[model samples]
Target chain A: MLLALATASFRIESSFRAQFWFKLLSGVLNVIARVSIWQSVFLHGAGSTDISLPQMITYAILGATTFSTWDATQILREIGADIRSGNVVSHLMRPYSYPVSLYARQLGARAHEMLMIGLPVLVVMGSVYGFQLPASPGHAALFILSLLLSIFLLFTVSIAASMIGFWVMDMLALEWSLRGTLALFSGGLVPLWFYPDAVANTVLYLPFAWISFYPLAIYLGELDLLSSLLHLLYGLSWAVVSAVLVALMWRAACRRMIVQGG
Target chain B: MRQSLSLYLYLIRLQLRTRLQYRASLIIGWVAQAFGYASVYGAIWIVASRFEKLGGWVWPEIALMLGFHVLGYALGALFTLVQLRRMEELVRLGTYDTLLVRPVSPWAYLVFSGFNIEYGGHIALGIGMMVWALPQLGMDWSLLTVLQLVASLISAALLTGSILTMIAAMALVLTRSRYLFGIYFDFWELSRYPITIFAMPLQFVLLSVVPLGYMAYVPIAALLGKPVPVIGEAAPFTAILAGPFMVGVAILVWQSCQRRYQGAGG
Candidate 1:
């Protein structure tokens, strides 16, 4: 699933004009980071006394990626819109699985974003801030693996949210509210570590932390392999539970479709 | 001017009527916006609680600044929602030509044509915050202070509206630009806090290039009896200047865009 998503994301960068703006924004971010005090403050606080280029790049990637997950629900809404418009029937008739197809498209979109927007921004920000690279190859590998897992967990959460549209008409408000909550709580706008300890402790139990904080923590060296593995275990558990709920919802939704001829 | 006032009232009434049709949705949107903004402010408050002051400004002063900023943003967004959202559509479809044909000034029509009455809720929220924060900040009430606050708000509205108009003008040139407006909005979002939080160069950029500093900073500074840093140094004079500058810039941009417009469905 992760491989498919990564492939799709890459495909988008190759095909779309979105790369121009992505590059422009990334360049602007790089310039801003180089000149802006906010960048210095963030770097000073996040890294050890001395920040390196790689560490800064890693932080930039982690920040952008974490924030990007907020868009997952929007992808779900697009899927729901397809279903409402009878487009889903065509996909259902195809040999390929419906969920997998949607997932592929989403993965493509994210891959495109990661390459065009995320990578350049990270590189620029890293160079400007002089961020340190990971101390060892093993840590880098661990970070990459945890990041992949985080993407999967985020995808699952989005699927779950999108499934709610099948039961409710006009999921716009609900989707927005959910996205806003996720952005606020999932360490997107502000890192979870910055929150009061009591709040952070409570949020750790929620699924949102797995979507952003855990993966970011792994990259920041805040979490070692053992701890990352434990976090992944929690994420996989949530994914299974969410997948089951989605299956149940899909079955019920199918029944509704037949009865209502929708 | 009398005709413009009447037209503004008529447009506002029409918007109010349209918004009343979706009472629930309007209320929900308002609540959601208030909650979202409040959460960010809450975060700021939490951070400030750890420190006695930020950039030489204490909590109440910060609250006042936020109050003005929120009020200005809400007013700008509500009044200019259609222009902000549809600048690209107008440019692409050449619908802006219709405004040119109307007897009213194209700039006036463009800025005031589409209103979101729902944003009235935001104004209420801003006022509530200002009132709430006033006592917390240990402010003494006076007639002059009240007048200054009202004047500052009016100036803020003008400054914000004009800046949006300037961005919209860019749309006329960059038709089909996906995130032109989004970029503008992101800039606006960046302005929510005091410009002091940013470094000196950024502070200059915000003041001169974007003029966001003129929005709430100037007015709030004057109201708080602080030395005005930029245009706010003139206080009421600069406050009055905002509207004319907006009208002038809007007219200039519209005139230039008119030459580029080729007409719709050609």
Candidate 2:
């Protein structure tokens, strides 16, 4: 059933020719913007930082690609619109669980987008602004593992936030709040290394770090192999906790929707 | 023109009543928007300040640029936020038919209906940034310079609004303009830093093609006696004309698109 739903989503996504092109263009431009900012920083700014320009370039590429994988605002808006238009009730009457079905469909759509748009951006930008390869074979392997974990963690956290839309009168505020929190803590745009010690120390352990910072850190070999393994375990734990939270919230949201006939 | 202004205000008053109907939502929206803008700008500052300077602009200078950028965006968004979302929605749902029959110009009706005060958060924060940075710069302020600053900021706001309005107009023909919105924002993101950071060609594109540089960097650079990209010294003053020119272009495009609009039935 999930596969079928994913296929349906894939079909729906492929139908939008203009959106595909726009996504590709925007994705490429996003990488260029990030890279250019860093380039200027290294050139004109006091360049005493431990991280090399090449590493920073690699981080920017990884950050841009990963950031495109999920958008909290987009997800919340989809849920908000469904609820507002009363289409969510129809979703509830379906055989499968709404959240699970939603995830499956999102997975399909995102898979299409990442391949059709994300890969091209990664390739074109990676070549134009040289990016570093994974530090070592071990790091490369672990980075892949961490990357997959981060995607799951991001989805769980975002869906949990989206569930709050059930109670809120307006999802716009909730959407912006979630987006702001994730963008800051995720270290997707600016790496935590640039952050002051006191702040970085706290933000380092946040669940949001596991979303982008940790994965990229692992790929960049910022951590030793052993520490990378341990962090992956930690990230896995976050994924579990967030997934459970999503389940609980989904239950509570269903009760509220039924009671209020949303 | 005076009558249109009054009607716009009247429509806004009605919208305020409706928007305030949910007091919690209103407060939450305001806080969220403010926090969102604050965090993004804060992150930019934190990262940029790590270095001695970004593209030869000191940290304080960057702050000033950011202040202008955010205030301009907030003002632009205030005028077009509803049209940004509703233009495509109404077109898709076939409700645009009702809007066309209204006696008022569709542009005015849409703009007034979407007038939101929630952007007070961004405006206040932006002003706070400028206030903080201006004193630090220690520039000799003259009446002319002060007037120049005011003109630059207004130009920024007007250019932002005009650009967004043009994109919103695209929904008249292309029903799915959501991705174009993302593309537009990607371009907007470039103006946050000094355009000099980019290569010469990219800088040219920002100046000529998109004219995003006029939004903040070019004007601010001119004011601060910094080297302006493309055109020198006179760039700031030239930027003032960009706003009005773009507004004219926006109106022409909007009118043409409206003429070509076949309604949702098509």
Complex DockQ per candidate: 0.24, 0.72
Candidate 1 off by > 4 Å: A1-19, A26-61, A69-73, A76-98, A166-172, A257-262, B1-11, B50-60, B94-113, B225-240
C-alpha RMSD for every candidate: 4.4, 2.0
Q: What is the TM-score of each candidate against the true structure?
A: 0.82, 0.95
Model 1, span B1-266: residue lDDT tens: 99888997887777678868877766776675666566656655543443445445666777778877889877776666556668778767777777777888765676565776656556776888788777776666789777867766777787767666766666666665445555655556556555555667767776677666767766676666676555445855565566557757766875786577565456
Q: How high a TM-score does candidate 1 get? A: 0.82
lDDT of 2 at A68: 47
Q: For model 1, what is the alpha-carbon lDDT of residue A124?
A: 67
Lowest lDDT sum, 10 consecutive residues, model 2 chain A, at A65-74
The DockQ for candidate 1, computed on C-alphas, is 0.24
Q: Write the per-residue lDDT of candidate 2 for residues B199-248, one digit (tens) a residue.
A: 89989999988989888898788888888867886786777888888889
lDDT score, candidate 2, position A187: 89
TM-score of chain B of each: 0.85, 0.94
Q: Whole-model lDDT, candidate 1?
A: 0.64
**How do the residues A1-262 of candidate 2 rate in per-residue lDDT, one tens digit apiece?**
9999998998998998888888788888788888888898898788478888999999998788765433635788898898887788888778998888878877787778777877888888999899789999999999989988887777777788888888874788877887788778888888899988888999999899988899899999999999999999988888888888888988887777753543
Docking class of 2: medium
